[model samples]
Target chain A: MKNTRIRVLIAKPGLDGHDRGAKVIARALRDAGMEVIYTGLRQTPEQIVESAIQEDVNVIGLSILSGAHMYLFPKIIKLLKDKKVTDILVIAGGIIPPEDIAELKKMGIKEIFTPGTDTKEIVEFIKTNVNTI
Target chain B: MDYQEKKRIEEAKKQWENRILNKVLPQFPERKEKFVTGSNQEVNRLYDPLDLEDFDYLADLSFPGDYPYTRGVQPTMYRGKLWTMRQYAGFGDAEESNKRYKYLLKNGQTGLSIAFDLPTQIGYDSDHPMSHGEVGKVGVAIDTLQDMEILFDGIPLDKVSTSMTINAPAAILLAMYIAVAEKQGISKTELNGTIQNDILKEYVARGTYIFPPLPSMRLITDIFDYCSQELPKWNTISISGYHIREAGATAIQEIAFTLANGIAYVDAAVKKGLDLDKFAPRLSFFFNAHNDLFEEIAKFRAARRLWAKIMKERFGAKDPKSMMLRFHTQTAGCTLTAQQPDNNIVRVAIQALAAVLGGTQSLHTNSRDEALSLPSQESVRIALRTQQIIAYESGITETVDPMAGSYYLEKMTKDMEKAAMDYIIQIDKLGGAPKAIEKGFIQREIQNSAYQYQKDIEDKKRIIVGVNQFRSEEEPMKDLLKVNPEIEKRQVRKLDEVKKKRKEKEVQEKLKLLREIASSEQNIMPPILDCVRSYATLGEICDQLRAVFGEYKESIKI
Candidate 1:
């Protein structure tokens, strides 16, 4: 009861096939004693939101490297909202430009990790940022 | 003379080691007891003539343009003509990407390299929900021949060589290209370019794969056979290791896995009763130019020599061109760091230099800001200039295989080649690359390597300047090229308009015909081209094939 494993669903939402970061984060989370479900590349926002809900994941991490985060993240957030799952923590990573970071945060992505992000820092952020419903 | 020279080399090495032990080693301890190459091949502190004791000039390092082209595939190399500086450019809708392509060509880019959006790459119309937000995001969106026509609007298909970095849906894209060329009054025979038609890497490294392996290989062989007769000028497949390396393969693994995939393609074509010489001669390769200078140069040289041997010995191909391993190099995208983004320019310059020194046939230098977002036009221009400056300014291009006879380079080349061949042999034992991929062997190997590399960086074993070391506080890169948010809407509207205008009956007939031939023992190209001519969308054509081949579910555990 004291050390419940946190469940995380990681999905790549968009066209970019660069998944080294996502896989690394998945490994880091799993190594941190969390359950990580890595749905491999090219998942639609609908598929990701559905997967997150199906897996009952506490954290949904989406990696988009193709500069589609502006179009993609908000869509994912909207779908999550439509599903009435507001308590689930949604964090996004990949090549999101500095100016767009604020825009992404405004769309309800709890945290956005940029390049050179330490996985430990991400784990810490997730541990602290998970919604306490 | 050999014995005396070897003795002298050994004595000189001993003296150097003695000095290092006394002065340098005592003052500064070595970084490790043993140093390994990126491939984990153990390396000696000093390489000398003794290391190349059995190295035969003709047998090993053949003259350029000769058998086992260790020196280079081209005799003059860059001297006769500089390697085609094909900057891989595409982002947003076809119109925007077209402007970029024309700008690149006008600014001295020798050819066009089209990067299709996700849906385009994986065989989906822009209107599909699976394609939402991704249409024209990473690359140009092409749902029909209409988009292809717009993409190459004024660009002559016959004159300018184009490379499409789309796999899985390569055949569909190729069909569209041929259709577009036909509309331009260009015959298929006169067109020249490459389709990164190598789909095996899609399953192994890149995750854009759609169909299963057997069908994918069939599609690749279809292109090989079709291009031999129809598009004689076209280089059929750019068997690629660029994605493999970016996916975190070591230099040796990249070479091994890529050439392994090449071997699989060759075998597949041969099994289909296609003459190896006819198709193998057109087989080109795409490699990644990573930050390791010596390793990358060695990788290129070794890949050429090994491929030549594989063709000549394994496949028994007599045509000299069939044995040659001509490759295009793109500077490693994985090495680019968003932190201190300006530093990526230097990183790309070094990697591009390695590719040039390694004797690339064509090269694409990545933009520095690419690690952050789609490169701003300024970043793309600078990326192009990096290639130009290297060609015009770097004196290294003055000589062929400038690093050919380096004691270190020669040893590393042989070592890398040997290690790669060992992996190939292991894969061969596992029933080849496809089987190896199915067994999750190659993917697991890459994942392990990727994990090790990341751990190395995190543990301070490797220093990535901007990220792990030499830390600096800087404002994030701003004004980065962002994809027009409304691109998906525009693309979907265009897709809808095309669908609405096209004859529904004809589209259905073509799609049905495609479904039939896709499962049968016939070349799927003609039917696919028919689908293209009928203005059947990429998703429709692929949907037909998907119904037969079934989508491949990745078995990779990680």
Candidate 2:
């Protein structure tokens, strides 16, 4: 199976309401010609994983500002593993502290974009990392 | 000034633009072809009397406490007793938040602003499955009346005012607060505080909403009807644009959306047959003070004037107090940068000054390290001291509306008022705020602005001091306040104990009564207060309302 455009799912996986960054990134991704589907605020880990699998997205970008990234991010990664899904790249962005980034990446998150990241960097990251076939 | 004088100034301005400005532009090119404010509103090279040809002093800019309160709300403004220095602080468990409250009060903070955790804000108990990994993370977790009591432990409700930043489950939290106050021997009439009971913003910007619009408005009006009789001094609703702005609205959109929501609330209350004067006076506002010095200041003045006219002409309320839009301002949190966190202190100080110059009634200054985590104790101390320095040392507070008569300021204020009023008219045409929200109009507008803002920053059109322009190598932020992960286990354990020890039968009865009252035409406050008094958890009561009112699922739009 081959894909024409990079499909990405931008999901907010916690109860936090700070979606400015997520919405901005989703649009930026779309502007960069990626097919982006945004799961609106307060999506559970199961919901996000299911959506990513169903949408056949090459990447899953989880945005959280609620400091629950330590617990939520790992649960999401494990869910992906248990579901026998291996093709998706999981990335995250928000008000994540620096010390927690290493652990999150070790849990299978490819990269974590903190506050003040340029959208071009994220677009470039997705284009460079995701393979079409 | 007369028309001839204005014409003369216009001619002179054109002459200067051709002679001096054009000559300098060719020799030393301007930094940018055009300059704009944070909202992208164009800024002229200079403002003059020509900008005010249509301005009417008596009708537009009146004295403090008069109709169209564009200058200042109070006659003496900060010269009389200064604005309340409040800081929004809460994290971890109840006891921890209580300690923070006492520490802030001891350090010359005049008021308290409680930040509830996500579960508490969204009407979930600490033990609920939805609250997993979220308990006591962002704010103090309060599951029931017991937790509320401990959170406010020794602080007398009569002495200091408290503002709870909770919506959707605001009625339940207000019930808990009143119950705690009753335990402290304080009467409801003597207590003064505010609840961020503006649910429209929740649907529009903040996503903590529970029920649909009709039922949500019912709950709000129920509070209005109940409070006018019992809690006379308490501010019934803090119609907020603070979250709207932080969620990436322009300054003009912030004013327009907030007042549009305010209008919707008033219309709902009036439809419920509530008295306008009684409930309207208790209505306060909350706004965000961002980095644009003159624009933010002008926004405050314009919002005050526009709201006064709305209440007077549109709603036809006769009480002068009903028209005064007293607001609490917080320094914009989104403007803070994580790259160089210490620079946030200067940003906050400038914002706090803008709030003062713009005639804010009360203010909460964001800490230096808030962009990374919850503000550290030392960072919060510095934030509070920023307000203190502006109050005592800065001589600006010595006068009322010191920036009032400047040509640039006056024109900018008028422009803001007109632009915001145009937005209100647009919202009204689309039915109202709630309808506009349901149609995703407000959300789309904010998202566009947010995307545009990011684009500007990335393109270097907008220079965010530490973020976009200045390059800095910084170490990881230290002394950052981290909520202990053990706090979640402790909170869940306490909630479980409360559920087990409480009289389950009484809890059911009270919740049953609440459902009946919510479905009926009566005020739902008394039954909700009963549910709180009986030790029923917040989630339990909201579950009943969920059954009756149903939850609101927003129409998602990118």
Candidate 3:
């Protein structure tokens, strides 16, 4: 079985149907020779967590634009904790405000990427931070 | 000029090109080998009469308010009445948003366009766990008829035209609007507004859909028949290109895909045995006015002409109003930059000018602070004043189709129409908009364009004044409007109060009737009105229908 490439999952976890950034990152990650999975719009946290566990992805990236990250991100983090999927590096990107970044980081998010962040930076961050199995 | 004069000019041009230009071109080489528009339309360095030597004025460029309206729709246009100054505003709770609406009206807004939060847009009440932190975040949280009543508390139904930006549950929101009007002692016939019931675009661009495609069409056609019979003044569907453009479709794809969706909606209605002439006049459009000024203006002109031909040639409708493509234009939100907040005001002003020059029937200028969050009060006021300044001060509104005879504009308009027509033909070959969307054709085109646009920005080939090429150090922005977090808790408590107080039996009976109507072929609007009047929550009504018409799960191939 093949197991060398870093597996990353990019998903939109809210009701806002903004998939441009999510799809961009998914393409970028795939171009970087990583296995990337994209869960389309309006996915609940439960669906995201279940997909993550089934795919056994190394990293999970969320793209939230609807300003519900305070509730949604933490809920996903708690679900991962309950499921004991702590090895997965979690990151976020979107229209997140500057004030919420620290709180999101404190909730076990490895990083917060806001608008204007380059996708090359995202690919590098995953390569360095996430431990490849 | 005469043929002799033209020959001399051409000979002079050839001599200059050979002698001076050829030598100078090597020393100062052209920056790039090719130039293109946002939609990948090739652009020449210059345009002249030779570009449109075969242009037809009477056949191709008809007068305003005539058949095949390549110009503006109305005869007198802004001279008779200025385009409606509608600033789309709604945030926090209903009472808070109501205050904003009143403030906007006081500031000379001619119409009200409500923006609902994601939960309300997707047909959920405030207390649902899915709506926990999103109750009133992006837009106002609308749960029950009570919330809607509070939204238009002091606004009279007969006085102002309202547009609600809701798609999946557009039928429910329309019922709530009519129910609120009834309480205000206004008849359904007196109510004038529009519901954005275009669902095909949801599958194409956004994801605010509840039911799947077939049942969603049923909901839309039910509104078409019901509103045609009862609320005669209401616009049934606003087939929108705004979201499609925002999702990064080029101007040509925006026109083609949106019109393709319009064709599908009309086909669905006609198949249901509805008269095209009766409902086609009320089928308005919404388009995005982006940064490319002349291109956007040409796009609007092209859209009107294309739709006019579609109505007359395809649908064979006889009513003049049926053929005219009346539309609302919103300044593009994707063009705004978070780098410099105040620069957005200037961007909005330019885009608004394009829409005005393009003869949009209505316009919304987005606020400067929208890229960060909901705009502050001052920011919104400035945005409204942007529209006001264009309508009152800008002399561009005096003459209709001022850019009509310009060689550049006419050629570009024809080119955009041709390109968009090609796309419509392709989608038509694939069985229409719905089947094309199911196959991800439209979505993939938008995604590819979006990727190219982003790549251009990152590579600095396309210069965003604040974002890509020119960035500077700045202090962090302050006083940006943040929705109060406690609004969620209070909204949930209010939803609980309604669920506890409303007559449970009446709500159940109405919901059951809605279920039966949804399951069968009967129109779903009357039972929906009964449910809303009985104080059934938005979630309860949508849930009852969702059980019959299952929720839509997209095929994610990205």
Which model is ahead, 1 or 3, in terms of DockQ?
Answer: 1
Candidate 1 lDDT over residue span A1-133, tens digit each:
2377789999988777788889888998999889999998777788999999999889999998877787788888999888899778899899888788888888788888987787888999988877453
**CA lDDT of every candidate:** 0.89, 0.92, 0.89
Each candidate's B-chain TM-score, in sequence, is: 0.97, 0.98, 0.97
Please compute DockQ, using alpha carbons, for every candidate against the native two-chain complex: 0.67, 0.82, 0.66
lDDT of 2 at B494: 94
What docking grade does candidate 3 earn?
medium
lDDT (Cα, tens digit) per residue for candidate 1, span B1-558: 288888888898788778765678777987898786655667787777888888888888988999889999888888898999998889888999999999998899998899888888888888887777778888899989999999999998988999999889999999999999899998899998999988889887788888888888899998899899999989999999999998889999999999999999999999999998899999999999988789889999999999999999999999999999999999999888989989999999999999999999999999989877878889988999999999999898888988988989998899889999999999999999989988989988998898888888888777889788899888867778767778888888998999899999999998998898988989989999999998999998888888899998876488
Give the range of the ten consecutive residues with the poorest summed lDDT in model 1 chain B: B36-45
TM-score of chain A of each: 0.95, 0.95, 0.95
> Model 2 misses residue B105 by how many Å?
0.5
- Native contacts recovered, in order, as a fraction for each? 0.67, 0.75, 0.58
Candidate 2 chain B, run of 10 with poorest lDDT: B46-55
Interface RMSD over true interface Cα atoms for each candidate: 1.5, 0.8, 1.3
TM-score of each candidate? 0.96, 0.98, 0.96
The C-alpha stretches of model 3 lying farther than 4 A from their native spots are A1-3, A131-133, B1-16
The per-candidate count of clashes, in order, stands at 0, 0, 0
lDDT preference between candidates 1 and 2, better one: 2
DockQ winner between 1 and 2, please give it. 2
